[model samples]
Each structure stands twice: as C-alpha cells, then as structure tokens.
Target: MDDSEADDPNRTSPRPAASGGWSRLSASRGFLLLWGAQSVSTLGASSASFVLTLEVFRDTGSAVALAVLTVMSSAGNIYLAPLAGAFADRIGHRRAAILANVVLATASAVMATVSLIGPGRLLGLVYPLVLVSAIAASMLTLTLTASIRRMRQDADLTRINGVTTLLQRAPVIVAPVVGAALYATVAPAYVYVVDGLTSLGCVAALLVVRWDAPPLAGPRRANPFPGARDGLAWILRHRGIREMQIGFAGLNLFNGLGVTATTAYVILLADRRWGSASGLAAYNVSAAVGLVAGAALAG
Candidate 1:
C-alpha cells in the first residue's frame, strides 16, 4: 500500500471494539484470520506486482510508460479513496475486505485473459485494469488497517502495532525471490492466474473469520466530500502534523521519478547479470534488506 493512505482523511473508518490486550487479540479468531489473510495477500500481490513490471518493461521497454502507469494510479487513488473508504464504512470492513479481494481476483483473471490473446501489447487494457485493481487494493488496505486498531485494546497497542508492522514489511523480503522464480519459470499469464488465486485464498480466510463487524454509525452521508473537507480541516489545525504533511508532499513529488528510475536500473542490471530473473531477485533482496532495516530501526 502507499504511504499516502496514512495521511488521507477519507481512509478513516469506525474503530473495532476494544477486545482486551495483545494476549486477548492473539487468541481472537477474527484478528488471527485477518492478519493471516493480509500477510498472504501482501506477499502474493508483491510478487504479482514485480511480474507485471517485468512484463511491461520487457514488452514496451519504456520506463516512461511505467512512470505514466504510476501517475495514473496516483490519480485514481486520490480521486476514489474517499468514496471507497466510505463504502467500506457503509458495508462493514469484513464484507468490504472480501469484496475488494474478489474485485482483485476478477481483475487479475481478466488481465490474464487479455495477455493470453492480445497481439504484442495488451490491446489497451492494461492501464484501466491496473487502475481499478489499485483502487480496490487501497480500499482493502484502509479497512484492514483500521480493523487492526479495533481488534485490540489500548493495553498492548505499541507491541501489537510493532508486530503488525513487521508482518506488513516481511513480505518485501520473500516476495521478490518468489516473484523472480515464478517469472523465470512460468508464463506471464499463468503468473497472473496465480495472483488471482492468492486473492481468492484471502477471500476464503476472511469468510472463515466470524466477527461482529458493525457499520459506521450516524447518518450515511450522500456526499463524502464534506467528511473529506472536515478531515483536511482537522489536519490543518495541527501545526506539527501539517508541517509533516508538507515535508512528505515534497518527498512524494520526486518519489514517482525515483521509483521509475530504480525499476529501469534494476532491469538493465538484470540484463547484464545474464540470468535476468535471478538478477531481479538479487536486486529485490537488496532493496528488501533496506526496508527491513528501516522497519527494525523504527521498531
């Protein structure tokens, strides 16, 4: 998920019932199921993402197109996040999460079909499908994250948060290796099918989780813009957070460029390294090392 979700006001949802401490949460079927499902989905999505990037670069050989894809995703997320979050709040997180997974699974299946038959390029289907998939993913992330807070009580908040943080970041280490191997061994369309299956697995996990997930209280607003405005207003009133947001904005301005450049660089390095897929795996490991280190330090 993007860091932007953290700052976005519309991502907010109703808090889960205080279920006790970390020990209690550990024993809670709902928390365990959600955590497990999220972990699997994250790893699968990460692998699928690398595969998609590899296919895009291999086909088009254009980092610019990949960059454009990122821009499209950003625009879609920013525009639809409020409505997505609101919809999640309306339906309850469990249902919303399940639906989001179903959406992703369906999208992956469609993309796979397109790739299977399309000539060279994707017959102009890649970007739109990718955009919708991203939007669903953002919604899923928001709801799942909010659900975590609700699942546990305040007593072990710090520890529970740290553990969840690790769970979220650990996939970076494993996914690249797995993705690279899959890319090297399987057809791209088959890899996409695998991605779709992972999402369906997540749906299964969510279904088995029995939780009394209540919808967001108060009258359902016809327009989410007002809530979004209120959220922004609240953030603006906080000097430190507002300043932090500004700093983050500056960082994000160049992040897309950096991501594109890095992806191209890695692919070029992969070509030079002979076994291109394996080389990509190595790069992913190095990058993951940095992420893990950062998470460790933050912890």
Candidate 2:
C-alpha cells in the first residue's frame, strides 16, 4: 500500500494496516500500552484509596469526613456519568482517558505535596482532593471501559477484561503490606506520591498509544444521547435482559447465611485483628484473584 492509502484509517475495502480488524482489537500495540499503564496505576489507585481514608481519619479523627467522602463521591459518579461518557465519545476515547489520568495524577501529587508541607493544618484539603481525584479516576475508567467494549470479539474481549481483574488483584496481593511499610517507615505523603507517580505511568502509555473512532460518513448526529436512551430502553424491554435481571435479583434476594453471615463474621474478625483497611484489602484481593482465575478459565 502507498503512503496515502496507508494513512487512510477509515478505508473500508482496504482496512487499516492492522492485523485483521478483529485481531487488531485484541493485539493493537497502542491498546496494549494503555492496558499495561492502567494495570500498574490501578494497583496504585487501590492502595491510594485505602491510605487516603486512613490518612483522613488520622488527620481529623472524624469518621464523618470519611462517610461524607464516600457518599458524595458515589452520588457525583452517577450524576456526572452521562456527561463524562458523552464527552469521551465526542473526543477520542484514548485522549479523554489521558486527560482524566492527568487530572488524577495532578490531584494526587498536589495532595501529597501539600500534606507534607502543612501536615494536620491542611486537614480539610485531604477529602476534597480525594473526591476530585476519585472523580477523575472514575472518568478515566469509564472512557477506557468504553474502548474495551469495542474489542475484537466476544471471547477476545473477555481476555482483555481479564487483564484488569488480574491487575486489580496485584495491589491486594502486595499493596497492603507495602502501604503498611510506607506508613511505618516513610509517611502518608510518600504513599500518595507512589500513586501520583504511577499516574505518570499511564500518561506515558497514552503518549505511545493512538486510537481513532470509526469515521462518520455524513454529518454526525447532533446528539448521541437519544441513541443512548434507545439502547437503554431496548434493554429494559428485552426478554433476555429481563430474565437476567430477574435472575440477578433472585440471586441477591437469596443470598443469606452464606453472604451476610460470612461477611459479618469476617468484618468482626478483621476489626479485632487486622484493622479495617488490611482486612478489606485481604477480601478484595481474594475476590480479584477469583475473578482473574475465572477469566483465565473462560479464556
């Protein structure tokens, strides 16, 4: 192929010079770069979440801040998702994702540095920064997940998803002890710094990676939200989805002694022995490991 044709990514007859389109989705060098970067930073993010909450408690001795932080962050996530998802699709997914990563990294770095400078005096800043950083991280996650949905094939997509589940477990397997070591030997400032630097790893990956959405042949829809609504509406009426939802609800409803009882027992045990953070880490790690193993088995 000549240079001009090679440059034309939207060409349908002669697809872009990638492994067949399907393979392209699975093994794109750029995609892999983003994936690897996210995996590492995601590990850092997990640890940061744990340490940040602890840091907040240590600084203020107020569980109220922690509760407020969690609730407000969650509320913001559901409220802002439509906008975040729309914006990502409007821009290039990869680019928006990078922007979100930058937001996260910068927030983490600023908070870490400020915490070191002011110590307890900067107490109010901790939860605010954490909220902003968490929001950015959520936006990044949604953008990346949108891209993942456009994968090569159903099975290959599963494999790609598996990568994340595996990465999620890594922090569980290693980060708690690591966070403890940092808290014991260094300081919370250093723990935040670790997360902030890992965000840079994502930035580096974005630098090397590129993705373009399928070309629009005509004027793009004025707004994609209607189409999005149609999708949700369709799912609402779909028999398959209906059955799945019912099954899911049933499963949740049926979860009894094994679920709540075990969880309660574990929580009490964790509180008495390991402390909440370490105990939660152990559970998440085990869950992540199970998910990864399940994904591998599926593959």
Candidate 3:
C-alpha cells in the first residue's frame, strides 16, 4: 500500500500472513498503548464503582437508593449510546476518546472535592456526577472499539478482540478486592482521587500514541438524530441481528434485576453478619471470576 493509504485511519490494512499467539498484537505499538490505557482505566473505574456502591448503600442503608444510582448510570449508556457513537465518528475516534477521558477525570475530581467538603450533605450530588461520568465512559468505550479495527489486520481482529475482552474482565476480578482494601484504609476522597489520576494517565497514553486522521464522511450533519435513526433502521432490518438484540434486551433486563437484588442482599447480609466491605468484595470477585471464566471458554 502507498503511504497515503497506509496513513488513512478509515482504511483497514490488508491482512498479513497468519501468525500464532499474540505476536501480531504485541508487535503493534499503537495497539499495545491503547490496550494498556484501556486496561488501566477499566481497573480504576471498576474499583471506583465498587467503592461508590458500597458507600451509597452504607450511607443510606436503603436498597432503593442503590438501585436508583445503578439505574441512572445504566440509563446513560442505554439512551445515549447511538448519539455518542455518532458524535465520536464526526470528531475522530482518538480525539473523542481523549475528550471522554477528560470528562471522566473531571467528574472524578469533582466527586472527590464533594466528598472532602461534607459527604453527608453532598451525597445527593453523586447521582448527577455519576450520570455525567457514565455518558463520557460510554463515548470512550465506543471510540476505543472503533479504533481497534484500524489498529490490526482483519485476520487478527478475533485474536485482538479476545485479548481485549479478557483484559477488561480480568481487572474486575481483582478490582473489588483492591477497592475493599482501599475503602477500609483510606477516606472516600482518596479513592476518587486515585480514580481521577488513572483517567489522567489514560489521557496521557492516548496523547502519546500516534493515530492517523479519519477520512471525511462528506458534509457534517448538524443533527445526529438522522444518523442514529438510520443505524437503528439498519439493525432492525437484519433478521439475525434484530432477533439477537431482542434476546439480549430480555436477558439484560432479567440480569440487571438479579444483579441488583443479589448485590443488595449480599451487602445487607454482610452488614448484619460480618459487618465489613469484605463480604461485598467477595461477592463481586466471585461473579467476576465466573465472567472471566466464561469469556475464556468462549474465546
């Protein structure tokens, strides 16, 4: 391929000769940096999520409050994913990823500040901040997923995806344990500070990694709704994909309910019995382990 074509971000490179193991992925400096940044950020975010849920449940002693917070967080991803994806496509994936991380870092910092001033009075602020962070995080995830295709050959896509999936899930397995330890030893403000620092670290990694400019997709649309609508229509038109999505929606609904109920039950049980965050961490770790095992088996 010519230098121009090689430099086009929207163009997928021709597949190279078959390779074994992670040789192809490990050889790509860009993918390595991207992978490291994403893995670290996931770890930080997962740990912070554990801490936040525990704190919220402990503070309010109400399962409803915890459920509300969880709902608000998921709502951002569910409702705004299409819009976020469209926006990221317009801005360039690398730039969008950087912007999203910046927003996430800022939200974490603000939460930390609120915790320091007075956690009891400021607890209400956490809900809005969580919503904002969730939006940014969804955008970040969308951009990174798009970037992965551009970073490797078509033949290596499956392997690269498997590696990414495993690394992402691997963090969760240990994040709760680390989070519980942090919660037991430090103030909540410090936990937020750590989360913010990890986000900044991701931003720095994104900056250092070289990225090709995405090709222009003609004139930019003033409204993203058209693109989102078109995308949804395309999905609906595909019988297999449409059915799969319907199945997933039902599965996720029940899974969400089960997870929420189980989390509340375990936390409450631990509070009454063991009286520590360790119980929550134990539950999370076990669930995460199962998820990782499933991913490995699937891969």
Instruction: Give the candidate number with the greatest TM-score.
Output: 3
lDDT, candidate 1, 112-211, per-residue tens: 8876774138726888887888889888888877776666657757887787877778886889888888888887788778888989988887766534
**What would the C-alpha RMSD of candidate 1 be, to one decimal place?**
7.3
- Residue-level lDDT tens digits of model 3 in 1-299: 24754565533332323553343444376677777878888888888889888877767777777777788899777687778877888877777888999999999899888777754466679888888888898998887777777667787789988888877778888899889999889998888888899899888877666455463478987786776688889999999999999999999988888888888999888977765588999999998888777866996
Q: Judging by lDDT against the true structure, name the best candidate.
A: 3
Candidate 1 lDDT score relative to the true structure: 0.76
* Candidate 2, position 122, lDDT: 75
> Native-vs-model 2 lDDT?
0.64
Which lDDT tens digits does candidate 2 get at residues 149-248? 5533455577767776555556556765566556556777777788888898898876555444433344555674657777778878999997898797
Q: Considering only N, C-alpha and C atoms within 3 Å, which residue pairs clash in candidate 3?
A: none
lDDT of 1 at 258: 91
What shift in Å separates residue 60 of candidate 2 from its native position after superposition? 2.1
Better of 2 and 3 by lDDT: 3
Q: Where does candidate 3 stray beyond 4 Å?
A: 1-27, 117-120, 213-216, 222-251, 295-299
Q: TM-score of model 1 relative to the true fold?
A: 0.81
Using lDDT as the measure, name the better of candidate 1 and candidate 3: 3
